[model samples]
Target: MDYSYSEHKQCYVALDCIIFGFDRKDLKLLLIKRNFEPRKGDWSLMGGFLESDESLDEAASRILSSLTGLKDIYLEQLKGFGKVDRDPVARTISVAYYALINLNDHDKNLLPEFGAKWFPIDELPNLIFDHEEMVSLAKARLRHKASNQPVGFELLPDTFTLPELQQLYEAIYETSLDKRNFRRRILSMNVLEKTDKKQKKYSKKGAYLYKFDEDKYSEQKNKNGGTKMMFKPPKV
Candidate 1:
């Protein structure tokens, strides 16, 4: 059987990925310097045209891996971008996806080859064509998702200290959190398992290290009927 829709116009479809990473202090965006035409040498999100043989998610995953040499990354489809003149080169609609990766886990050597660099979320450069908008939307989605779920753990190391976890939240929200209250709230959830280990990097006494208990969290979520895990700021 032959499929034909000749009456309608045809346009190119692409997938853009907003790769986010946390370096224990700040939230960063992985961007690539475009070496090709239509804005050569400008900073842009890693993206590729959607292929006939792959789904949108697969396209996003492929593009992310091609640029970062990472696999099994946490990815979520953000939104679709389609404007008459969004792409100057051609009539293209891009599906945007955001990916979270642990900074310490990615392949560093692949970055240089793809002209990729991590930029602090607060100090990003001027991006090409509505990419800045895509980034802004992605950031909001990340903050929202992190608040309702344990997705923020994707940006942290396998094992982390309480302070490190707090820092990650602060970086995501771009605000300071009350250490005492924050610690209380997080522990009250009972989703973290304390390991018999301490991190001596930030403090003299060292903070106890902990890891997210996925099984426990799932059980808790089920018991609570799918309640969201939100970060409540301490009242001043």
Candidate 2:
């Protein structure tokens, strides 16, 4: 190998994260209002230039943790955007990653420092550059994965009611689910363990709270031939 090849141009590599969260009411997106150019003061996904020492995946995780102060999050690479003009200031190619996180879990103190804010998915402000397209692709990827896997649980609290879980599915799929069928299918999987605690915030007679049964989930995965817990929905 030639030790020095100055013939090739070096362009910047960046990672952009489309973080998803659920607030027990609706699905949300975590966006930042960039404080510096090239699109200063515009809404955008959390991003950072790839450092010389880190892999692309490491860069994604670092960008996410810097915003949330949490690690081992559910993150996946969506795709790369390499359009010639995708980035205004440089010949930068961006790898887009999507993350699912519990809404109440992140460090809120960090948001102000980053100018980060949660926007309801439907009400997001205009994003800079190709960031808007990045969100659309990320959402489609999320829906497809969530259709086959219980990854949606990453956006939920430790314990939740059946109603809350149903709402989460509805939020994820963006369609109304038959409440009866939804509950039946979920309980049929037998992956949730009922807890003695009841969530009374909804009413005087609150819905029972349940936590995901890791043991049962593992058994189900084995029974499923290690396909990862199936979260397929009924024909709704």
Q: Give candidate 1's error at residue 121 in angstroms.
A: 0.5
lDDT of 2 by residue, 126-214 (tens): 99999999999998888877766778889999999999999988887788888888888889888899999998996999999999887
lDDT of 2 at 37: 90
**Residue lDDT tens for model 1, 205-232:** 9999999999989999999999656566
Stretches of candidate 1 above 4 Å error? Answer: 1-3, 233-236
- Give the winner by lDDT: 1
TM-score of each: 0.96, 0.94
Compute the lDDT of residue 214 as modeled in candidate 1. 95
Clashing residue pairs in candidate 1 (N, C-alpha, C atoms within 3 angstroms):
none
Report the backbone clash tally of model 1. 0
Error of 1 at 27 (Å): 0.5
* Residue 8 local lDDT, model 2: 89
